[model samples]
Target: MSDFIKRARAAEQAMRSVFPATPLQRNVLLSERYDADIWLKREDLSPVRSYKIRGAFNAMRKQDGQDLFVCASAGNHAQGVAFMCKHMGVKGVIFMPVTTPQQKIQKTRMFGGDHVEIHLTGDYFDDCLGAAQDWSAEKGGYFLSPFDDMDVIEGQASIAVEIEAELGVPDHVILPVGGGGMSAGVTTWFGDRTHCLFSEPAGGACLRAALAAGHPTTLDHVDTFVDGAAVGRIGQKPFDLLRDRHLSDVLVLSEDRICATILELLNVEGIVLEPAGALAVEAVGEVQSFIRGKTVVCVTSGGNFDFERLPEVKERAQRYSGVKKYFILRLPQRPGALKEFLGILGPDDDIARFEYMKKSARNFGSVLIGIETSKPENFVRLFAHLDDAGFTYTDITNDETLAQFVI
Candidate 1:
């Protein structure tokens, strides 16, 4: 074993004093569905509902006399640090974006109690991180990076140590890639013993971008839907470990599609997963052929899902599944034309939204329409009816550029 892996194993042993090992359970439902021996490394079951606590605990344990720690995160990392701060009787200062969900802020406060003080700054996480570093330097306190630090990376490698010890050796391991800390650490430990599949949210594929550039590069824009894994840039230290990796091993999943997986696990298996946590599980469908009849382990990285976002998740899932669509139709100014169009609607089709835009031509007006149906195929039938009836419309369901502005 490499020196780093050996140290990581030691760290794993030390962590048992702080918190028990996360469960690695055989998922019978997933196993039967995929025809593979599927197992879940439930990092979500951790005290902070994420694997981040491991990194925080290991790093803090090694810093013998440090009394103060600082960090910036929108959710999981912040909560993990707060929990550790309280546990270790150390003072911590946490910085988070002002737009961060209130649930996360409340949870962080609950975990840290009197040991941590949270400062909400900046509209974006990068701004908050910059502020945190400045404050740490000014206050002469230790700054705990969410991913970049070597100690944190080694701590994250503990996940691999536990998995190997619990399962012996799986044929394949799937992990969600965010800033690359967890992926780098775990992959380093496994080495060539197991095939690794790295998954990322398409909106925040920092690892993929790093692999393509041969180093870390910042993305101009990032969708923050998958808040836990939506990193705009890969961490420098973690990127060094992952720099030589093959691009083919990395898979990017659409944010909307990830919502479908979140819904699937919840409905089918009673598993509640945040968007980032579901990345590895969602990748299984993409790599089904390779995992068939093999022992496959998926690291579910977190379960910090806010129940308030459930409705939005369901909406995105339906849109991605093609069961929902939005369109702008040209309605004739004549009163009977509205009756004629309504007459062509299928029995299964339901109008979710209908609003008149404005009268463009003397004989016609624009109408925005949102339709929902039981199946994606229903849209094809509805479109045929509209075409046959001489109704002109434009489907805007898949138009990302326009949806961002209008929807």
Candidate 2:
């Protein structure tokens, strides 16, 4: 075996001291839907609810005489480092953005207990990361990078090692990319041996951007919905390994579609997944024809979703699938006008919300309306009816700026 493979094998064996291998379960529903032998490498089932713990523990264990380890994260990586600190009885400083969800902060504290100090340092993660690095330099402490370090990459390679042991090499391995630590390790481990598909959220598709630019590039805008994988730039080290890869190998999924996948896995399979965790499974639909009659494994990266976001997820999913919409309607300032607008709805259509706006207008009043329908095609018919009834309306469902303030 090659040296990297040997090291990965050693890493997997060492990981047993911290936690067992995450499950590699064949999902019958997904398998049947895609017409392939589909398995989920359930990293979401890990002790820290992410595969990040593997890299954290491996990197921590390899080093000697380090009493204090530090890292900056706003998600699973923070929890993983905290969990490792408690497990190893070492002290750690975990820096997070001020805007991080309370649930993540609480979980990080719970995992580390008294061994870790949580610092809410900056408004954004980059600022928090800078604070952590400066403190580490001044204090002479080990700074643990979430994905940029070689040790971390090797640690993440343990997932590939476990997959080989449990199910051998699959025909295709789908991976979700954030800063690309896990993707780098898994691809390196299975180089040229298995087909690989790299997925990223469309709003935070740093890896895809990097591949396109022939190097790591910072994005102008990123959707933080899939917070775990919404990195602005791919890590330099990880990008070096992926820069030469084919452009077609990368798949970018819309943030809304990811919500739909999250909802599907939750409602259909009774499996709760965070947005980032659903990325690989969501990509399966994009590559359905390629994987038919083949063995495929998708890494479900994390399940640290805050249930509070469920309403937003469901809303986004419905909007993306055309099952719901919002519109600004101009109604005549008369009694029968309101009833006429309401009468335009089909049987399957429900008025989810309605609010009056600009009521003082002399002839016409503006109204914000939300409608939910059973089918996407239903909207086409509903709009036709509205046109025939001489109703003036503006669909604001896809207007990001307008929908943000009103919806």
Q: How far is candidate 1 from the true structure (C-alpha RMSD, Å)?
A: 1.3
- Going through the candidates in the order shown, the clash numbers are 0, 0
Q: List all candidate RMSDs to the true structure.
A: 1.3, 1.2
User: Any runs in candidate 1 off by more than 4 Å, and if so which?
Assistant: none
User: Model 1 lDDT vs. the true structure?
Assistant: 0.91
> Per-residue CA lDDT of candidate 2, range 103-214, in tens?
7899999999999998898766667888999999999889999998878888999999999998999999999999899999999999999998999999888998998898
**How high a TM-score does candidate 1 get?**
0.97
lDDT of 1 by residue, 150-243 (tens): 8899999999999999898899999998888899899889888998889999988999998999889998888888888878898999998888
Quality of model 2 by C-alpha lDDT: 0.91
